[model samples]
Target: MDALTRRSFICGGAALAAMATMPAVAATGVKTLKNGKTTVDLVANKVLAQVGGVLELTIKKYGKVAVVRTSKGVKGFSVINLACPHAFVTVKRSGNGWVCSPPGHGSEFLLNGKLKVPPATTDLKAIKFTANSKLLTID
Candidate 1:
């Protein structure tokens, strides 16, 4: 085996550090109704009460999705498909946004699903939803 170079070691460490910052919060309080709508209980997923919080889940109709808190009001949440528009690979939370990692072409999107980098010609797909004080219903 070849000896490890200092440059390679530093690069490897940097890559690991970047990956470590990605959020991996699981979906909480998810309930599928008989009528086919899905509901998330804000009380059970308290992280979503704060701005910038994200609750990731999968919907039967939409596949992977994220519910992001953009502001403090009841209407401040954004529901977006997590699949990268470029390659349809699920994006991972990175810093203040999302990144289309391996198997994708490195498309980037803001927390609200706005396109920030390309390879993707559009923003992440938005899903319709309604929110009240306690629950957010995905329609």
Candidate 2:
């Protein structure tokens, strides 16, 4: 492995320090739906019209949810929360996954909400959803 540079070290240290002191985010403005059988009309959701498209939905009790059209034959969609489990910061889409870079703390998670990098020990919270034809019923 390559040795860490001084600049990289300093930046890393700063990010970690920020992560340690960052507070949980205040209430989100997005109105989340109830955690029950909530139906999402695919036809109405233009973003999900194409395969590989990702739709971010907000639930009443839950936080931001990332709903993606999966290419895998097993299922058509995968849904997960967008908040970083470690810092409560909203994660941004990074390549094929989600990444949280709040100050010094850096974390990455797969689209399916699996942890791909650390500073985050746990995977993102999964939101259960069932797809039928063009509609998805989330629980």
TM-score of 2: 0.67
For candidate 1, write residues 13-125 as lDDT tens digits: 54457869766777778999998999999989988999999989989999999999999999999999999988898987777888876655667799999999887999999
Model 1 weakest lDDT span, ten residues long: 7-16
Report model 1's TM-score to 2 decimal places: 0.85
Candidate 1 Cα deviation (angstroms), residue 36? 1.3
Cα lDDT listed for each candidate: 0.87, 0.69
Top candidate on TM-score is 1
The model with the greatest lDDT is: 1
